[model samples]
Target: MERNLELTIRMDNDHVEIDVYEPESGECSQIDAPLSFDEHPEFDAAVGNEIYSWLSLWADELAGQN
Candidate 1:
């Protein structure tokens, strides 16, 4: 099934921002307000199943937080 969700991300020297969009029925709703990531932690590695596992957990946590 096709998800109605879309993610847009932007980053600069100062901060990072994420926007989630939902489009349906000739209308679009910005489901999530843009979030700033100024205090985000650093990740040294990005490879393999570990990344997938982390993302899955992160997604769940983020959902709950929101």
Candidate 2:
């Protein structure tokens, strides 16, 4: 089964921001870091995975609670 989640990424001059949204409950979470992709080309993918992992854990926790 799939959870109703949305992930958005935003990049600016100084930082990169990631927003995770759960439409079911109208809840959201954010993660951000300095824009250092010049030094770490894989940063975007890494952050994406981290966000996905976090959402999965959060869903599991909510399921357990229910």
Query: What lDDT does candidate 2 reach at residue 26?
Result: 88
Best by lDDT: 2
Candidate 1 residues lying further than 4 Å off, grouped into runs, are 25-66
Among these predictions, the greatest TM-score belongs to 2
Report the lDDT tens digits of candidate 2 across residue range 5-57.
78899998988887878787788777777788468555676667866786787
What lDDT does each candidate get? 0.43, 0.76
Lowest lDDT 10-residue stretch of candidate 1:
39-48
Clashes of each: 0, 0
What is the TM-score of candidate 1? 0.32
TM-score of each: 0.32, 0.53
